[model samples]
Target: MEELMRQQQLSNGQKSERQELTCSVLFTNPKFRADKSSTKDEINSIARMVSNAEDLELDRVFRKVSKNDVEETRSLNRSLFEFGHNFEDADGWLKLEQPCKDQLATVLRYMFESHLKTTVQIEINNMYFNCHFIVLQVYSRFFSELDMIPLLVTLPENAVSQKAFMLSYKWMLSDEPVLELAHLVEVYVAATYLRITSLEAHCWKYFDDEECYNEDTACALYVESKDNPAMDVVRNLMLTRIRKFLLTFVATKEFLDLPTSHLIYLLDSDEICVNTEIELFDGWVTIGTRGKRTFGV
Candidate 1:
């Protein structure tokens, strides 16, 4: 019933082709998993991994495309899941599996549709797999597939919002050039975390003596560019909310890999200061905002 309401609200009145394409993405990637892990811990693990971050790497596949495909699609993004999707389970929320699958499909379609690029898809997949695996570890400690309210919020028709968030965050933990992707994940994480998990009593204080980078290092980041634009986006987008999260939960093994108490102290301690005359992450300012957002953080 709730799913139906979401689909109904999505009556954008676009052409039948666009509507069909969006619906088609969902059919293959159904909303619920009949055989979702039964155990509480297993379920949370599934939700956390499945709903970790945005798939920034996946977004890149669509950024550039063949001239012909570009003309045909009208939009550069073969955006499979940007439109609204609704999923709500009042009794007991189920996993938003299809939404994640749909976004993944969108990324795949964009990549393959674009010219034959090198196997960069592997990096995206690796990041996704690792993040899910790690979330599974943490989730296993708690519950199996958490009530997605604690995971990612499903839009009226949006499923990937949660999972894509996980995808984005995974890159933050990754080593740049992969680590560079953290900047993109930064905003998405803050926004999503703020939206979904209003954890008890969060604080935001500037790090007076934080361990930031030197001017030279910042310059090097902007100069260096691997085929990985995902990392580049994250490095480019900077904010305290996202930065602190990555610096705490991601940037360090001492953060996620270590005990939670230890990481809290690490985050709460004095900010690691750094010189930034170069402005590596703070390069170009596109829109009215300081930085843009991707699917992940």
Candidate 2:
């Protein structure tokens, strides 16, 4: 009986030493201290290797005891089970599952949704937004200037519409924000006003895609882009599309609804295609008459 107790005690001592060694290796290992730039796959791979190493160590310990020593084997088995349970509860490995951006986005999203630590309120077209100044300053140069942010700030109704402001707010809180095609132009305008260059760049990428433009959007896009000197690229792209599909665009109500300046701009494009000179002249006359009646000119 004394021999059995001695063996059990030895087993207990070994379990304690093994746990300490595991912890030391886990905490002290350079690979375990995940770098900020490490991908999720890399971090998870490291975690799996560490877990496998721990299992091997436990198995090696179990093999040291004789099969006939039932009590000692049982004690070691119980220790291993308890260790695993405690380790799982610690959740150290589980934390590595999310990449840094995802983890940050999760926390930021929670904070934004909960309205936690909000330092400023922005009003747009009677809609109010509670925002964190720290977060805004990070993404927006307009907000970064100390004098620009105030307790209750109101945006100019002419510059940013309520829906556009709401979408921009969503962009600020998300790692990967989605912009709706319907509001793409408005959101781009808001992003520009806010001086959120990253958001502006993202919007430009959408504009640069030929697939994003079509007959329904092309006329309105041209009207919106024509006056803005900063939107020269977008205006040129619309011109290119109109030139390529002149007859199709001329048939749309949106084309007839174009302002006189915009109609003239389209007429002035030397690259515009038509089946014949007379066909182009008739289309221009129809568009010109519609512009005159609409503008009451």
The residue pairs that clash in candidate 2, if any, are none
Give all TM-scores, in the order shown. Answer: 0.16, 0.54
RMSD in Å for candidate 2, one decimal?
A: 24.1
Write model 2 residue lDDT over 138-247, tens digit each, in one string: 98888887675589878986667888888888888777788887888788788878899999999988787767775446656876777765566677678766656677
Q: Could you tell me the C-alpha RMSD of candidate 1 in Å?
A: 38.9
Residue 90 error, candidate 1, Å:
59
How does candidate 2 fare on TM-score? 0.54
**Which prediction has the highest lDDT against the true structure?**
2
